[model samples]
Target: MIQTSPKTFRLHIGIFGRRNAGKSSILNTITGQNVSIVSDIAGTTTDPVEKPMELLPLGPVQFIDTAGMDDEGSLGLQRLERSRQVFDRTDLALLVASSNIWTEFEAKLLEEIHNRKIPVIVVLNKTDISPPDPEIVKSLREANYTVIPVSTLSGEGICELCQAIIESAPDSFVNRPVILSDLVGPGESAVLVVPIDKEAPKGRLILPQVQSIRDLLDNECISIVTGLSNLPQILSRSGFQPKLVVTDSQAFKEVAQITPPLVPITSFSILFARFQGDLQTMALGALTIDNLKPGDRVLIAEACSHHPVEDDIGTVKIPRWLTKKIGGSPQFTFTRGHDIPDDLSGFKLVIHCGACMWNRRTMLSRIERCLRAAVPITNYGLAIAHSLGILERSLSPFPGLLNTLKTTRSV
Candidate 1:
């Protein structure tokens, strides 16, 4: 049996260009498959087409071929808008352009990519029909852009294009941050508390729990897995002292009570907040819960779309806790998957999920947006612990963040 990495673990490379610029063709040729519809028509690809595969020397990667940025008309504009959204998650961007053509569309797109601080490679496709313009090439080079002139018809520059992608891959992806391994040293042990609830999959542990266990094993650390019922037994052993205790956010209060105060503790979602996003920012956002007033608007964002169970964490539990904490019923708006509202100004606070389904870049982009909107954003785990008045205790493993929290709380 072969193991496959999840899309969230893969490098996200987005290919962008105007209509018929061979964006799809480049993807098909490089991947050696017809991943996208390659048509001469301007608006053939009305939505972003994604292809996930192993790119050697770069590991797993997902190539996103988007609709033309310069698309016109009512429907065309919609497609163009969807293509623009791809910028938020793109780790590496391929700005495809036809050789001998340098227009505002390509320039404006490049500017947008630059504004986001994303690494971009300029691919002047269709070089067989006409050579690349020297002035355009020189201008791009002067701006420190890697310019690759390619003719997919003749297989020219395909190898070089792949090399450029390999080189431009983000450092974060190459050297990923650990979920919890850094907290526990080699030969040390950590306890993982996973509760079996209605939302828990039939027989499988959740992604965060499984990944944390795997990360511990990979780092030569021992991982003790148990449910809320057995957590007490594991902690009660006289000679057994775990370096850390990680539990589901919902089980925070129980686990904190059972585990000794000397042992550092946290939740899987909180670990993910540091793994997938800025911990300090989310921690600060969690502190803003004290300022939430009655009738204040709150946005709950979930990365994975699913039907609501009876006591769904996002829909029921979090809202109930917030209502109790605020002593009033605040307006709660729920958004699942990629449906984050374009305008976030109406919301007083944005509470998001662990985002296990999304890459770090995507989560960071969302966090960045919330900051720009001046709205405080926090993840489910942080929000839960804070509302329960146990957030400071849950952050024990991360002393720097704990000290920061204490200082911020004093203010």
Candidate 2:
């Protein structure tokens, strides 16, 4: 029997360094297992390796061992690119240097890590052979970088490294937000409206729905799940009033019609818009749709790759709605899963999915990328509501966001 947490729920720690710097060895020691193929040969770990384990006190963590930044040739460049991609999603970064060597490569890595504003710990490995340079250590310390010397051969300093990681973890991870529980109090009831459509998974709910139900249960809130057809009956039944109602965004219109005005109604995507990324930025991005021209390029990003049906949401439905709103179809570019383009300059606006399959770190990373490129990015739920002319009503749960929408509209 295996007990494993969802990858998205774990803290992502990326181990990065030049080739043969014992990056994989550090991962092996920390995980107590050979999570990566450690070899004296350079560039042996061609791709990023992931290890999910429970790091005590820090809770669940996913360690990613990436290829060396100093890799050579065409293949090496690709590997380096992949490693950089991993860095974009890392919550905490471990920069491994061995045998007292700290060069421009390490400095550049430090610059990149610091630019991302990610917490980092510098590990000086192979201390048995040669300890870290005293001058280099002093300089790094003066710059406020935590330096820990460890030897994989002797298992030295591994404990300190783990402790450093726990201390360096973002405060958001240590105190996670309750998915749906915060909305409905303990003993209160929540009604989930799930539409069983062609896109629905066979015999299983999507990740967001499952997680929401589990969160309600964990928060001691009662949850009642119903399909779109049965939602009216469940809501109108005698002597039962749910504290809140959450529906899939695709069924927002029907659910809104069926749900009464007094009940607070929201969508799973809306919840995730706040949970995984910056809700305020996404809400503002929703207003950008009015500025989209017919030929303006729009990027539609989805976190999970799935086969598209005739009426797919990302490619078909959303595009259809946007065309009607903008008076013509914008150049729709679709990117599935984690392959968010590095260059967002060509796009006028980006409409992203709820990102239930992604962690908060990854979602924020994408949002940061969009911000850097000066591209407006909004999630599916907000985009849908804005196009449907009910964005203000749908965002009623968050009064601040509603005010933001009003201010932006007035401007």
Candidate 3:
């Protein structure tokens, strides 16, 4: 049976532009909260600020306030890099600009957004200052874009802009991927293989396990929780064949061998990838492991900060696993939290954690960055499934993705 959380399907609208373009002001006016740091000085908001709130008619949407794109000094370059990073997962790109219209910077940004196939919403902020330039409107329209004129101070055109954002966002996102709850029949069973390793938090299963169980229950599925060692026996003795078996990536090898070929076996990482991102694109990245060389550096990136145990998967276990499977020892580097390194060129492979805390746009944006740098990126689950002998077996749950990966690897 399939299970999913409601929050999984929300429109991720990102507000990006030059420094002090009233991005924060627009966010504050929309959410009616002190969400972004409002300051007259340029570059006050150096990091990406995200706020999740209900937009009328649009429902639950995330407003990501990004740093200035035009700030000049070395610090500005870093901020600009981060702002550019937001474009990858932006369902709707709101290019906040003044009445001056699409400057050279905005034009360049628009080109990048369109090149990635992301929809754009040119928000002409501070309309109260002066009428918007017709040339800017014409330029965007010529490129088949949508533009909305608005002023945060006077609230003029704000309503129209919000409505336009919903209209301009990707047509399919309005329904939000038909959450997993929409997939399975009622009263089915799903077996979850959670390995309780030393790195497994002291008393609690990780967020993915807890959330998956809750989602399955909500979707009217009976979820059986067991560790890797006992999974085979449980499935063997079960009264009915499980509809699905979701295992942690760490046990992909053992779990694959134990699971019958007929059963639809997949890893929590793959499911999470489906739950959180583009499955085919991420799966293709997993093939990068085949090309890894001994001296190449691979970045192991995670979203949360924890007191890592001796057997921490990101630090020790993953490195060991990669070396064992690939037959070469790539220099492994680790990074935690939202800040990705400024320069990613050194790393040939970027293995990211399941970003439960981050919005989809952010994680997808990271994947976009890796692709731009000509590096391959994969998630923990996908990588583990690939390294294990059962990658093809695990992908049985996702037919479309399985076909895509088969095609990509063949290419």
Candidate 4:
């Protein structure tokens, strides 16, 4: 990884507080730059501002300065909502309070952070004006929170705040889960079938494909890359037998046809289903496709926003296949990028993309969001496999997921 990495690959630390609580100042101090505008007027920083930098021992980390949690008015509500959404991806939170002031807003923010199970460090800013109340500090300490008093004007206690964040970051951030190493051992061979279509980038593979190849190489395995047209010949005439064969989800049907039944074959999306999010839950959620009613609503979500071409997968193909299979034209809603709605009230099911652009924490957060809304969420690969009648075969790599689906659903 380079010094300037993607935001999804960085550890996200969110600075949250009420209006004029020196949240922006703390961010500027920590980053040693004016990343966010500092002003005396309340609600100066409306939307969340992000600053990405390299933090020692923790690698890349992005600090997010959010709007006041106590903003009031029509537009204020929207800003507040956006601020709260930051919790979805936050690895660590800094609750900024100043003048020894702690109100319902602060308490509510702390409760929300604790509810999300994110580690938090309470920051008492502007201690030069009014020092932290001993009683309040004691109460916070009793709750097992590390409270630090800092004056951004004088740059005091910034080191302590950074140290707290470094210590509190989750271990999973450093030690990430393997994409396919656990399945393919050292010295083993795996063939990757990448279909070069118009949708494919010129002279380059997609992120999932690149990451899969890199993972195999990192595990000391032999990776063979070939296009879909040559997959049959490769499988038939190659002197080497691969431990697994991975392909793009869109070509699952074709790959399944050519590959032998004994060879364990899967898609890039299926690999990500285990890498980024819950595999079994998503596999079980795929069962809901069979139970869709006439007027059911399905949400199609993608992580990256790209120009839509004719017969787009998320917009056109999946919906057409689903509607034809269900014998009804179900209402479909589309969302792309980071604009995931917090309220998933009326949606019966959510079909999400592979989320290769996002980190494990963000993907899990989206899954939890759907679960909280009492909605079943499945990814593109699982849904595609289920639609093509190869759901069981595609999920064969995972030992118990197919059996779980069998016991739960009639299929």
Candidate 5:
């Protein structure tokens, strides 16, 4: 898959439409494979279907096929919500409409796209069956939308459609990945500290750890791996003085204590902050730790869907650490998986997981929502380091940025 990594070039284009509007069919024709299941029934695709491929002019691209927007009933409403969720992360939106009908559903979706400032292409699908709608053409054209009629089955106008999508996509999303990789120069040494615990996957490293290592390798930077128990030893014995140390948030205390003040250090979560999320917003959220009232409500968010471990950081460890630091009991609400609470004003703060499995677009959208709501959102590592009273030390990696933020916020 083409990573939407800040180091790689990719365009995240999402395909959306009403039930069975040939969204999947259009995808199959474009990709030349049955990547998404096709069905006559509406709401067949409950979850967003993703595929990554290289288009000639566009280089690498990711396509997301979502469920119909007009789905009904309880289950359909849930599916509809899932489809809407894709909007926040999409760099480009393709609204697949049937030539037979154009309704309020498309208009509302377009309004949201406009609000989000995402460029869109209104696709009139199944053109082989019927002529274009005059009202649809007039309405969309007046609004300055590019509407193209396409036949997925007959394979008509597909080449032109692909070029149009490439033309409409933002250049920033395609180039963000490359900028992140350029932050650290080639041939420098970086250390990664990963702690192995019950929550840590057995016989395998987490996605974030592996991806960071791979990114370093790709840039020709030398990396040394160590566990929390022997991080000090690893630093002492390594041949070179490491330029950066990346660690798991669970081991932030020990890592911060052992590492010398000169050598830069940070967590995998911090790297995500700089690359996948808004670092400034999270920095502000971390500052809210001092003001958490005794009875104030806090929301703890996690992304990966699974049976949380007994020592889950998001559930047990983080809550325990915060309560211990505050020295008072506070109301805590836990929302796991994708069920994030809509009314976040009830909570004073929202502490989110590192979001290893989710893409950058989704993470930023979640942060943007928190910004819009005026609710502070900090991740597992920042919250942990903040509560432990060693945030400045934990953020030793980017001394310039970290120290500047820490110095300004320190009381």
Candidate 6:
């Protein structure tokens, strides 16, 4: 049986260009599939279309084909806004333009891509009809951009475009960080506490749990998966000791009690705080919880959308916890999936999910946005641990972080 890699693990390559500029054609040609609707009519793609495939040598990649940035009118503006959001998650960008056309649309798009500091490959499409203007190509090349001339109609330069994508991928994707492998060394054992609950999928474990187990195995470490009921038994086993203990954020209190003090403890969400976003920044953000006042606006953001359970972590539990911590009710706003608010400045604090469904780029982008808006941002795990008054204990795995937290608290 073959298993497909999750979208979160794939490099996000966004294809940006104007209407009817053969953006869809370029995507279809590259993936060898009709991934997006191809039509001569402008604005054919009203929403971003994503295709995930193995771009070998570079491994898994997600290609996002977006609507034209040059879209007009009210409805067109909405589509354009959606396309702009793609910049937040794009690890690499492919700027597609017709060989003969150089307009404000392309210039603005390129400027936005540069502002995000995303590596780009300029694809001058329709080269078979008219070779890319020498002056335009020279200007792009002089700007240190990798320019690839292609004709989707004739398949010319497709191989070169593919090669350029491989070469331009972000270094972080190439040298991906381990989720928890570093915490548990080879030949060492780590306990994973996963409580099977209503929110848990019908049969399979959640993405973060599955990925955690895989990470340990990949590094030749032993992973012992269990529930809260059996955690004590696993820990009490004669002559058996694990290097670390990881649990769901909801079960942190119980798992912390069951595990030995010598063993490091953390949660999947907290691990992802470091894996997907800036850990130190978030740790500091969690510190701001003490300063939250009643009625302060807080944004709880989840990367995936699902029906809220009675004790939904985001909508229900976390809010209850925060209210209890603050001794009063605070105004809470929730956002799911890619529906990030246009203005984050209104919020006093932003509590994000583990972001198991999103790439690191998207998570980091949100963090950067919060920083720029002067709103402290933290993940579910860090916030929960801090609220429970065991954040320092949970952070014991990283001694340096513990010291940093101590110094910050002292100050």
Write down the TM-score of every candidate.
Answer: 0.98, 0.95, 0.82, 0.94, 0.86, 0.98
- Please report, as a residue range, the 10-residue window in candidate 2 with the lowest summed lDDT: 389-398
Per-residue lDDT of 1-411 in model 5, one digit per residue for the tens?
744432123467889889889899888889999999998887778889988888877677788999988889998888888888888778888989887778888788788887888889988888999978888888899989988888987888788789889888776665556212344569887888988888888999887788788888888887788888877787788565788777888887888788887776678877777667777678669888889977889898887777888887878899899999888767899887656888887788988877766656678888988888899998888899898887777666555767668666775
Taking all chains together, the TM-score of candidate 6 against the true structure is: 0.98
Point to the candidate with the largest TM-score. 1
lDDT of 2: 0.90
* Predictions: Cα RMSD each: 1.0, 1.7, 4.2, 2.0, 3.5, 1.2
* Number of backbone collisions per candidate: 0, 0, 0, 0, 5, 0
Flag the better candidate by lDDT, 4 or 5: 4
Which wins on lDDT, candidate 1 or candidate 5? 1
Q: On a 0 to 1 TM-score scale, where does candidate 2 land against the true structure? A: 0.95
lDDT of 6 at 360: 97
Q: Candidate 5, which segments miss by more than 4 Å at Cα?
A: 1-12, 33-62, 72-76, 100-105, 133-144, 178-183, 237-239, 403-411
- Candidate 1 positional error at 372, Å: 0.5
| Residues 141-207 of candidate 2: C-alpha lDDT, one tens digit per residue | 9999999999999998999999999999988888888777888989999999889998898999998
Worst 10 residues of 1 by lDDT: 37-46
Give the runs in model 6 whose Cα sits over 4 Å from its true position: none
* Model 4 per-residue lDDT tens digits across residues 186-260: 999889999988778788888889888989999998899999999888889857578899988888999999999
Sliding window of 10 residues with minimal summed lDDT for model 3 = 175-184
Rank all candidate structures by their TM-score, best first, as comma-separated numbers.
1, 6, 2, 4, 5, 3
lDDT of each: 0.93, 0.90, 0.79, 0.88, 0.80, 0.93
- Model 2: residues with Cα > 4 Å off, grouped in runs: none
Select the stronger candidate by lDDT from 1 and 3.
Answer: 1
Per-residue lDDT value at 2 in model 4: 48
